[model samples]
Target: MDFPQRKIIHVDMDAFYASVEQHDHPELRGKPVCVGGGKYGVVAAASYEARKFGIRSAMPGKLALEKCPELIVIKPRFQRYKEISQQIRQIFHEYTDLVEPLSLDEAYLDVTENKKGIESANQIAREIRETIFEETGLTASAGISVNKFLAKVASDYNKPNGQKTIHPIQILEFMEELPIEKFYGIGKVTANKMHQMHIFKGSDLKKKSLEELVRIFGKSGNYYYHVVRGIHRSEVKPHRIQKSVGVEETYWENLLDEESVFKQLKLISEDLEERLRRKEIRGKSLTLKIKYRDFSVYTRSKTQEMYYENLEDFYKTAKKLWELRPFDKPVRLLGLSLSNLNTQEKKQVSVQLKIPFPELD
Candidate 1:
């Protein structure tokens, strides 16, 4: 008998961080909400209400406040969010060992042969969503399809408590109208360039010769061509020895003091530390990036034999980097990254039975 084709499901939580914020703080429900540090901090999350006012996550708190003065800013409660994340992850694990977490609020599940043994990934996705809602009192959207790329797009087809599935037979029609912006790895810059090339949709992308696309846009255009053909193989990788994790900050005003640099390093540490804990990954190496007022840049890194889990260790390393670099100009940006990963938690992952090769030309 022929082995069954792969079945993939993508789950994305709607405005995850912001929704969590609103859920806990009942008074803030239905109001324009943006989670960030106070006046001097960065945006950590933006509610749908705040998003309508042109506010977004990673935007400066000051600018977001300007956009919506009424915007309610909530300081990040990472521990709470991480707790909720664990609640969500537990739900995915029940379905298969092949769940690949993209972030706290999103994941890809490979269930070709699953605990449910359901023929339709769409049915599995629905059950998963129903279970998550029953257990967590929160909602999630899912997309089901044969491959990772198509599954991801289908999940976003409906948002905020919805589900969408694209059967193999419907793949061609789906690709024909697939918006360029909706394509994975295609950002605002690529979308504008695609428009310039008269490629508004997959049909337009189909008109271009692969060689012509390659000549203009390099390796990405080659991938775009495959996507246009409704044939892209974006794998769903699990927590597989992450090579790097880092945080960068853009300062409101140029900093001339060592204290200022350390302060931002502290802030980034606090921000990234939460992510590290959620992913259950740690680092044995630290990298510091510096950008000067004139846009000059430098990077310095140090590694210890042992993994670091506390803020004190990260701060000491970052402070040492600041002291060693000794820049003459004011600093406009500071970033902290942890690399040389492969921490203890990574060893716990299970190896899956590999599938045979695809018939790619």
Candidate 2:
């Protein structure tokens, strides 16, 4: 099957949260820093300096401290991060409106027919990176390729502040040498499973027949079979509708009692409320996620007839659900999410035309 050629560029901010903290506080530029709470909380974002000591996001703060005693921890300023993210998104609009945001710190852009009518996706990526640095004083890395998957993988090849282009002619050779673990959708668990099967790299994965892959990994195996052959068909959706909105946290210390548990829930509810209000979003269903000290997870959901979007309403329902939760084990994590959002999908305009590619150097 032949598909129309497309130009995709994945742009990822370098050490986003930590870089933002450093940019705002020049004194911390060269020092090892992370945006997270101390001792009891987890590392949210570790700067390259802290990464030198093997510190990473989601690592327990105590462990991070053990690795680097001089690591500076800063509280996350989400509002400030959002402000800067908006500024960056504006810059993307200048080149293309077909931008699919993966997160506040990264996005995939389809510039096959960009607003600027730029033919070279590599040039678009380079200009975007330079503009991001100039306007926000933050570095971004970009990957330009014929598809989103290749572009996503290429973006990460050069870190902090660099760009990599995966030309169409280089696709097969590139995929063959790439590690299975480095594939965008392949998680650690899946990668380990593939390793046990001696499928350690893209070359090894490509050896498996479609029937064999589907039999082992189910529907996802189909995705694996196609992507490994340099055949990813998913388009970059500019107006991807979100189905749910959530906020979760793993506490440094376990919530040993109902009072502590409810207290944490209240805090989480407040945060969720602010997020919903910021986006002016409401949902018909609320879900409460609980993780015990033993790491066992459970969820309880309640649906209301009418859509609600207030902290009081969210907390009141969440408190009731907690009261009836099973097994009163010390809670390790608590989360609240609103699903069945009142989001209407916008009409999509599709362009199906083969595009010319630039020659690789």
Candidate 3:
């Protein structure tokens, strides 16, 4: 019933984009700040001061302004963020090379065999957070636990310059008391579905049989079944392969007519072609993603008979897919991605077992 405890740490930067702006500009410090377009675009990142006014990333800027009249909206400086992110990453490499970046602001690190030979994961997390702040002037929160899922969940427990460690002894009690929505990877829709099934918390989810869960959630039911019992076996893959290449843009104004939509698609197609060519990869499948003004998304995909690497071919297929689907609302975002790429190689993952309840405890 017992297994080796692997130390995993999830490091999440606090308000990365907004914090960079605030750190660079002293005048913006201690004020409600967000990084994104003003007036029409969505908030890319909201500072803690802005978060106090219920402003959050991806919220429409108009709504964010209404919530905080004095909010300062700034355009994102991506290159600046990247520079800071690289500095923080160097700090991570000092401790462990088994680092998997989730984004510019977050990463998973397996410090079980860290270069520093530190024995305690909690101490490593503390040092990492402190070093990130000292070097980048940006605060980070970290979670340390026996596995990725638990470590990711624990990281959020303490926010903006805080850290938490979930020991093996606390895993069962922690999962039991956790809300279903609090479980990492369970999105809003899935959480709502679980609510309808009376699976409000981990304890409630634990009562469902594997058959019942699989019947309701399909293959994901198996995932939920295992993760809820602290059985997430997925490792920190440092060199995860790129599954798809795509580009998307959000408009300040909605495209109400098909002509405008097509123009945007053409531009996106051009970008996708350049991206694919730059990577020296070709794909058999192309996807068109449309996000309506109401924030609902719809996608259509086409698989060509042969791999394609040029704009002309993919654009034709994208346009064909667009003509096939009927739009229900004005469009705000459009994107194109190439998949089933020639660069991809098939790899099989081992099936995880359903461990007994006693194993986690």
Candidates' C-alpha lDDT: 0.78, 0.85, 0.84
lDDT tens digits by residue: candidate 1, 15-116: 888889888888988898977634666777888888999988778778888988998888667678879988988888887878887667888899887886
TM-score of 2: 0.85
Q: Tens digits of per-residue lDDT for model 2 on 1-361?
A: 2444899999999999999999999999999998884776678899999999999988878889999999998988877998999899999999988887777898888999989888899999999999999999999999988888889899999997999998888888999889998888887788899999999899999999999999998878888888888888788776545678888877767788888888888899999999887776789999999987666788999999999668889899999998786546788789999988876642432212221111111
Task: Give the clashing pairs for model 1.
Answer: none
Candidate 3 RMSD to the correct structure: 5.4
Q: Which regions of candidate 3 are displaced past 4 Å?
A: 1-4, 37-39, 188-200, 252-274, 292-302, 310-331, 345-361
Q: Which ten-residue region of model 1 has the weakest summed lDDT?
A: 352-361
Give RMSD to native, each candidate.
5.9, 5.8, 5.4
**lDDT by residue (tens digit), candidate 3, 254-316:** 899989888888888888888776667788888988888777888999887799768888778
The clash count of every prediction, one per candidate, is 0, 0, 0
By TM-score, the candidates rank as 2, 3, 1
Candidate 3 residue 46 Cα shift, in angstroms, is 1.6
Query: 323, model 3: CA deviation in Å?
Result: 6.9
